[model samples]
Target: MKQPTLPFWQVWNVSFGFLGVQLGFALQNANVSRVLSDLGADLHSLSLFWLAAPVMGLLVQPIVGAASDRTWNRLGRRKPFILGGAIAAALGMFLMPNASIFVAFLAPMIFGGMMLALMDGAFNVTMQPFRALVSDMVPNEQRTLGYSIQALLINIGAVIGSILPFVFTNVIGLDNTAPKGEVAQTVTWAFYVGGTALLGTVLWTCFRTKEYSPDDYNRYKNIAPKIVEKLSLTTKLANFWKLFINMPKTMRQLALVQFFSWFSLFIMWVYTGPAITQYIWGVEAKWFDAEFLHSVDVIPADIAAAKGAAGDWVGITFAAYSLFAAIFSVFIARIANRFGRKITYSLSLLAGGIGYISFMLFQNAEVVHVNLLLTEIDIPQGALNLLLPMVGVGIAWAAILAMPYAILSGSLPADKTGVYMGIFNFTIAAPQIVSGLVAGQILKYAFDNQAIYIIALAGVSMILGAIAVYFVQDNSDSTPDERAIQGH
Candidate 1:
């Protein structure tokens, strides 16, 4: 039995919640390093602090995946988990930037780190079910389109989330710089807005999407309906171990690809703020040191202002890449169908590799003025050139969000889709965990504490990921006639 092709609107609704989820993530990625730095985290410890995100994913995703597989309630199988996770994530978003409020209990950086972990844990709980839902609902032929639509919504949310801080600071004239121990109002407001948006969008998806009943799911996926039995803890653990040991061949092959891809992404997220501020704005790393902050009543006015401006600009650069990814997602399904997923994914990662490598090439700090409609804004000359590289990163990001899942979904057993999808996240989480563990040391010893070289290193890793993609076997490849009919 084949799953019925959902209407385009239903397909669109299936992934609409991802928009809010990605919004929360984009804010985290674009600003967390800057937030931690402002809260007194040092340059050498940024990656360690960043470990909170992937670490949470490693711990949360599989458990949520397996639990959701057996969950069937009035709220629907995936929707309950999705709604619950979103509420928790929204709370985390509201609290993370305001960690300074809890300084009496713990240091601001420590509090912020704890909030980051909570937010990411909730994100993982929400994300894995969404991945499995697409596979469960969409027929084999529409898988690429389903995932591409998801990628599109994700990037759109990212674009908006990435730019909110900049919009608050630059357009609304919010106070971008605050005291040494406090976060800027611009960032604080962005989080408030993002948290609200996250709840609203996720609620839309939960209310609109109707999951298949157990019998219907079994019939559609061609699986025999077995008695629902509550397994003991030992049996559950044993089953999880068995699944891990015998993961699909495609999943195993894609692990290396995922490793390189996420390692590069982790580096970019952890270092981009410091890289842009120090490399372009010439802000010293020592300025953010905890001891230094403790000794001085207030940071020097110039350094504080420059750091604030640079942080805002970092948001713009991240938003640029997300915007590019959003644009690329529209045609990604057609591209994958035309050239094959392997070729499409490989070339995209190669482009992102080149983009990351090019970051070091533009170092000019001269200011440039650009008029937008009725207003003019000043931007760094070097920073303006940075958007060029983001184009490549954007293409790779869109493919990264869509292609692997499209390939892996075909190879999964019908009833086990949720567990396998959760298991696949290990590939994404492990590389990031490794990168977080060693990246700061690499920067300190090999790169002489220069964050820009770390960006270049990310480029190399992406190229390696591009090479590894060729080794994966794409079980979901379409025939020539199918491609022709799909307008590829």
Candidate 2:
């Protein structure tokens, strides 16, 4: 079968929806901490607040993938779902900052999270096919460039999303304070912008992008639409159970690695900010004195003036790592092509592991003041140089974004693309579930609520995840042609 031709720009347009998808993800990642903290939730309970996110993903992703497998529209099968999810995300983003209290807050948070899940599911509807588009469009040799382009877009969107808050409170002069723990006007504005951007950008992809119709896609294989005629809960369960039981052996072995890897990350993301503040910066002493509690999410917000050059530096640090990914994604792709996906994965995990562990070495209870280790002095939060740490995370992030899919897609039976893509996502979600349940519990009992140690464990798990990669034997030689002949 001749591969269909695709221009480089077409790939960009098709991936334009990622502009919005990544906007939502980056905002969610960078801001969720500050939001939960502001809403009177304790540090330990933050994981619980975040729990709703993964739970929704666990419930929504596979079903969405399965449904979209049969769906078709004038725009496209995946496009309709993508549009719907964007609307859901936009609506939820607008509503997120309006929560009144603890339990009540979880209501909007969970509802909002469900919207994200739906949006994410919708994105997945297109995601696999979009990759298939790359596969279909690019020759075997150019596949690295194809994936590199996608990685570039992923990080560019992330860079923009991560810096928006700093732009709002510091530069835009939006009110950053609310009396008695109310959500800040600046945060509300950020959501509004996020909602608007999320929809507007998704719509950009919907119009600018084009997908292979069934006729085009069927050229490579005699693909028939596997429509789910049944819609009841029992029927859904029955279908899912069947798929679960019958998952490919390669996937079965790989899920364990995914489970551990994501769990470690979830723990890191949920706890890192608070850990840095309480255990590292000891910002409590500054704030509890009622003299100077900083409102900056990553560092204390300076009250007297707008952001100085320092805040911009934080944005630079965050974005620089992403830039590193953009540069390195192609390098990783070439390495994977030469060395195999599992080896590239092992190296990535080791990089992240070393990155996380590096924090422990810098866990000084004192900062130099007046050229002395003064007991009576405290340093500002941003004073810690996080450049190396962010770079380490970038390596992990690059691996998380790429290698698993490269290995999975090459090995999976092409006909099962949608189902298996959905299954692969479970690896990302399950870890979030484990982290929300276990990290806080471990923090309390084992480490006396020191969240930094969880990162050490995360580092170790990632290293173990690296080691586990050896277990995934590549079967790229087993092609779609072979699978059909074997009645797979």
Candidate number achieving the greatest TM-score relative to the actual structure: 1
lDDT of 1 by residue, 347-419 (tens): 9999999999999987888999976443467878898899999999999999999999988887889788888
- Evaluate all candidate structures by whole-model CA lDDT and list the values in order: 0.90, 0.63
State, as a TM-score between 0 and 1, how close model 2 is to the true structure.
0.81
User: Which segments of model 1 are wrong by more than 4 Å?
Assistant: 372-375, 477-488
Task: Supply candidate 1's per-residue lDDT for 192.
Answer: 91
Question: Which candidate has the highest lDDT of all?
Answer: 1
- Model 2 agreement with the true structure over 1-488: per-residue lDDT tens digits: 65555677876776676766767666666666555555445556677767776776676667666666666679776677677777776776776666544345355445444544444454444454445444544544455556667776777777776667656755677765544345667667777887788788778977887666776666654465565465888987887788878887778778877876788777766766555655555444233211122343433453211222222233444565566666667588666656656667778877877877776765554444422121122344333555577777777777777666665666655555666677777877888888888777787678766766877888888778778877876554334543343233
TM-score of each: 0.97, 0.81
- lDDT score of residue 234 within candidate 2: 90
Clashing pairs in 1: none
